[model samples]
Target: MKALTASSLTGLALLALTGCGESVSNRLMAPTDGPSATKAGTPIMRGLTSSAGVVPTAYDGNTSGDGSSSCSALGFGSTGTKVDGAYSQKVGGYQFTVSGSEKQYLAFAPSGTPTSTILAVIVKGGDAYDVYNYRNNPRTSDAGLTSPYNHGGNIPTISHYVVCYGPYTPPIFTKTLVGVMKEGATIGSMEDDLSWRDHPDLVIIPWGRTRWLDWQLSYTLPPGVTGIITENATTVCGSLGTFRLQCTFNENPATYPIYTWSGLSGQGAVLVMNDLGGGGAGSCGDHDYTNTATLALSNGTTLTASKTITVRVVCPTTP
Candidate 1:
């Protein structure tokens, strides 16, 4: 995949190849200096439809405070696993998809005001859990479990992530974005390029979060084809999507760019929505499918948005 900047995009030059954004690159991932205080207007979703049928339904609660704020996992999906108990006053959890084998620092910060102490856990499986404080990790309660791991230690990527604020009070508990930071790197990075590069002439982040939202994408498929497979041109046919709104990370990887989404469980980050079916055929005859999603953000609000996604399945030409 060729890593190009946004300014370099010509009349379909960058799109013709697998062009990624600043936060993404080949073997090289991007990170920022922690979270930036972004102005929250209707999340600027241009090009395609993603937010239900709305561009970005304004925050149901106050846009100022953390109320109804979304608990964003940059590369995660729309759904999440809700949890409650000892550490969690109000928990919002989602399984994370590790992109590669590189050890990363899991960063968490409140939306309205950044806080140091947030109750976060890496649930491996069963009753076993790796608990910690995001910034001052190393809160492993189990003697056998070595968590809050060293930057060079073996970390579990294909695991569940649950986040809540410590001292858990009303609201502002789950209002955070769980971001992955490679060791020595700063903070803040965009999710992988979710745009399906098969077609150079399309728009929309389609589905994803940049600034935790604002995105675009497009793809072509043979009519009626769906789920994990490739095309006649050997293009990987199905989209790897989220099982829940958690980013898929591959703990054990043999290649770079190991973090990807898919429809197949345990494959990549997400399970591609099954019904993104092609219409009949022909580029001019693109069918419209509205991709709608309602999310219960960690900040404690439910958001719903809708937009039309064009599904194009071109009829093959006789050679």
Candidate 2:
């Protein structure tokens, strides 16, 4: 098998899997430095959207369910990068100071999360909070609105929360994790993401199977950025028998964090970073970085997705 490089997301020797009857040997063509392809490429998956109910589009600043409003019904339309579950990649969340004190409003789109009615979006400013959820319909699903959240007033150090019950096993959500925006502004000051993609957009998985899943992932890992996805994950002994972070590439090919996972089916991680400036590749300032990752499944299918995460750094000063 040939090696997979992250610099070129579109080109690579594909790993073709052959199936025999009801069972098959699942495998992913692994890179030269990491584990063998057969070890990292098994085909067993997981999911986070199993239970929920009908939800209204935009609620009127109330923790409890309030009235609703649709963009079409009110002469508005929805438009943007519309994908099913694209929001799944944004597990760590984003935070950025949008404007330099300009009077604006926030329009948000929580991708791939509208289908789960059990989910809720809450915003906190000063001492009060509000709720806004996605409207899973033909007219609205890309983004949602937490509008007039400031009333053109002092936009205090605001905070946003995306939470869901039942499936969350008591909701271990990152309270301040969110992707917020205004009419014309950035989502937040710090945007962290791991945009996971599956090929054949419409391909459905065969349920109740344990041998159909193996994965090989490649990331356009940036320099001077140290965070969850960039560093080696922690796995204590005896923590076996379930899905966990298998292994990450140790900068073998340069510019990419090639990795493999036992199962990323229903996993979420907080994106905490340390821009300590010891990497020697990064300077103090807002770094607008564009990264991408390609996930190779055991079924011989590959998926690629790109993301733009802008992180600002402040260098330490000495006497």
Candidate 3:
């Protein structure tokens, strides 16, 4: 296979994904540094519509979700540069900042500590683009997409994404390990560090205009787990047997921790101790948890772990 270069397709002018357009591989959609393709067209934003014709702006600090009361419009040039709407404001204690003199992006975040977990946008003149929604401590490649090419893995480098026209379908922005809060650090921060890049305009077609972008911050992610086991006791030490084990962590406090079991004994045999992962606590402190492991021995003998576990396994019938 040919080596995929991030820079080659980063500026491919928003070509169509079907027919003559290049189709990306599945690897690109799963967080792999795979190859990418670009379409040849200017980026464009969509317009939202409501029964009232258009969304009206108010002098007082108030914004409406109705399409007639709020709308954003975008235009693009052949050179893939944006021509209008590059300003932002606040509503309901939330901050909206838009960027992209050429191809704009919109970023929204809470004001205080300043961290953006979700990013959305329309490519001013183009129809296709990428939106990266991240969590508090966003990690590289944690973003999602609805590009012509659905490449996953860590979020792609910003420069690699196309700001071209679209007849596009984007997925709902989900929480990643990082977010727009890091849009400003440096080129490296976008791909390495967790600094926000310039908080750009997102593509929320509020009202009848593609002019306004909305990033709701009430969403969060549940913490993930870490750790696994190799095999069970009933199986031969060197024999091929399925070992069952799992561990989890909770990132979002709102969601409680839940556990599932896997192994020869089937499901629900094992329990996820609250003491173990701390129910997704502040420090994720010491993992002093407990659980039972059962291994069915073919031979009339018992097996034990090198590290003493909470419970012992009962030997099955001797061969």
Candidate 4:
């Protein structure tokens, strides 16, 4: 008689179970790390998929039927109970805890009606505990295509819990600075010409997620100087979970001055002013100017920041 080796014994066992089809032993015999294995040396169990060969659905932000039936389908107890607010439950082998002020329960029917619906408990601006998909009903396999709770076409009438938080905080601007230029006297020059051309543009700094809904600027020029020529006002605003706001000196040229004060350096916001060709040579003297900037936010909030700068052009005295 021939001795039966371990390999031969394993082969015989496999043949015997061949008639039983894909059993637990068959999965156990599969390779440790592959599509079939959850990890190294860990094969997935056949029980994760439904015996009826029905897949689950995914969760989308659509709700139906008061969310009770959907929640119940996920095995969260009865339909008539007040399942809203903070609560914890184990669904599809995962422990889920949701806490918040506003709770919303919704039924998710990714495949539309007549198909199984998935219960979704959403908690807004709150935290969820141990929320994850089941290993068996992976989002990969076609059999696990549908959601975990809506398996085998069996509507479990479960309940999902959700919490909703309040609105987000409004945006704000801070840490603003303005730039100025001072001119020196030149040899043999009659007078200094103080034009905005010699100085850099104005700078404005904003902080937080600020969205500028409206912006206006007013300026006071020196005596004999009629008006000022400024570039078009340009602003950038968008939503980054919250609102974000930014504005530049000029839309076309886009030139901003760099300045450092009190050991901090940054490219402060700027306002471009064209040279009006005023301020005669001997008039090379310091001129004070005031600029007022008004900004409005999408949240109906207004902000005001002002900066005063001096522009000077001096002349030399010849003997």
Candidate 5:
């Protein structure tokens, strides 16, 4: 983040007062008295496909039947007891059954590619239900269910199922300020540096007033800088009101150059960075700054974006 010199400010004020056209560089280079207004755009939902075909496997919850208690207390069934081995069915080439006493189970056959990745599953019923990744680590089992019971009156039946891989690298943006005006306005266009490893699962739903998703932002300061003032603009929907999101960021003396915002959805779903730093001033420094934004779904699928920015301040000299 760069600051404008006294001379530059004087010239900018003159141009504005005289109704003269301003250059883009001048607009971006201008110092902001406060944070800038959010740029609005439609939120995107991307789809993901498995690297290879996967076959479903059967996981019986009855410890006596399988001689393994790994799923003893993990099923959500009518009797509230572990599912009987007979509770097996096939749907869309995937095997589905009850596991433990409170969880549903699905199994995927081995694939040629053995790379590690997160799997997201959705079990739809009267209301959409998201499955949980009980095994937190990257898995090859390809089978699991929601952590808690859907508890939709009757045994929650699988209305729909979808899977995708995750824990992806986020997109980064870097822009050189060449113009300015007052603070809290559009500075300039940003150059995107997209660096990611995996594809995020696509989630499509009808647009509604209720907030089906939530997010938070975090800031990282550079080394040696301290006592910096920071503020987060209240999160709100975009003007289009069609699944758009917006927020603000500010730091006095602007120490923290990097910030990240992440989101999570569904029941018992724990994303790595969810709701951090409710927005306030804090100590920061002059170091490589990184910002992260993550979105998680009810079926245990997560999407993340991380940006690292290097702050280079070039103040103008007074002539």
Candidate 6:
């Protein structure tokens, strides 16, 4: 298997061929070529892609051997089980594919706003590894010259690097990192080169919160389906509170029913209808009379400006 960094392939191969292991001549090379020229999976050298996508495995805190039963035991697959090739797994509706060695898994929390969290589990062939807090970017913009990791000794060629923010939290899952380093791939080489070689291309894996809502579901407003717009709201039908008016609509066919309304109101509220009441704008309310949800709209229907929406609800006496 190849190391995370491709630059070390040549020299590492030569050293292995000569049988003179861990020699000085084998180390140190061009910045782009990596310190060693070998293709082995080191902790930092391995790359993981879940069934959902490719996630990174950092070597900074990995502990594994090359070609060991424990290290080789790790892999990713579509089923989240051990496979011959790199394994891939789907956890929390996300897919990942992993390659290389000395692998480990981690979980990360969200950024500045901490309303959500990400849960991920790392796996290997023989045993499951530890899961640690993965995303914690505590980095300040460096005019693009300084290394992000000064806490460690000897830095490699990096374009840019940033520290994760927030406190460190351990993984809730039982697994740690799985997989071992490949032949001729050493931990030292990975630290000096692959781990953060090119900060610009480092590809930081954010183990933080992922959006629950499918924000990509934007469609044109259809006809027959009215677009409702409201302004600052104070009463929501005698609820004794101030909130925004809720709106809902439906689609034809009703085969694949999907609903999306109110970007401002509380999480799951029924949209009001035909009015914003106290000094609001336009019309707003439930669009779908059937049990179905219309995601798209026909032509000739007008939509109100989204900026005019303020979701404040108050109690309605007419209740």
Number of the predicted model whose TM-score against the real structure is largest: 4
**Tens digits of per-residue lDDT for model 2, 1-319:** 8765764432221211122111122121122332222212321110011112222222223232211222122222221111111122232121211222331112233244333222333333333333333232111122222222222123333334333211211111121212321111354333222121222111111121111111122332112111222222222111211222122222334543333333332234333221211112233444443333334322122344444433333345557
Of 2 and 5, the candidate ahead on lDDT is 5
- The ten-residue window of minimal lDDT in model 6 covers 208-217
Tens digits of per-residue lDDT for model 1 on 89-121?
A: 223322222233332223322344233233333
For candidate 4, write residues 70-184 as lDDT tens digits: 3344443333222333345433322344322322212211121111111223321111111122222212112211111211212122234431111122223332222222223
Q: Ten consecutive residues with minimal summed lDDT in candidate 5? A: 41-50
Q: How much is the lDDT of residue 274 in candidate 4?
A: 22
Error of 4 at 34 (Å): 23
User: Which candidate number would show the highest lDDT if scored against the true structure?
Assistant: 4
What is the overall TM-score of model 4 with all chains considered together?
0.21
Query: Which sections of candidate 4 miss by over 4 Å?
Result: 1-149, 152-158, 164-171, 186-319
Candidate 6, after superposition: displacement of residue 16 in Å? 15
Residues 1-319, candidate 3: write the lDDT tens digits.
9875766565352233322222322212321221122233221221121112221110111112221222211122121112133445442223545444422334444444222222112212222233232222122111112222222212111221212221111111121112222122455332221211232221111111111111121111212111122222223111211221122232234443322222222121222111111111121112111222223221111222222112111223348
- Compared with the true structure, the alpha-carbon lDDT of candidate 1 equals 0.26
Of 1 and 4, which scores higher on lDDT? Answer: 4
Question: 4 or 6, which is superior by TM-score?
Answer: 4
Worst 10 residues of 4 by lDDT: 235-244
Candidate 2's TM-score = 0.19
Q: Estimate each model's TM-score.
A: 0.18, 0.19, 0.19, 0.21, 0.21, 0.21
Alpha carbon lDDT at 149, candidate 4: 21
Q: What is the lDDT of residue 284 in candidate 6?
A: 26
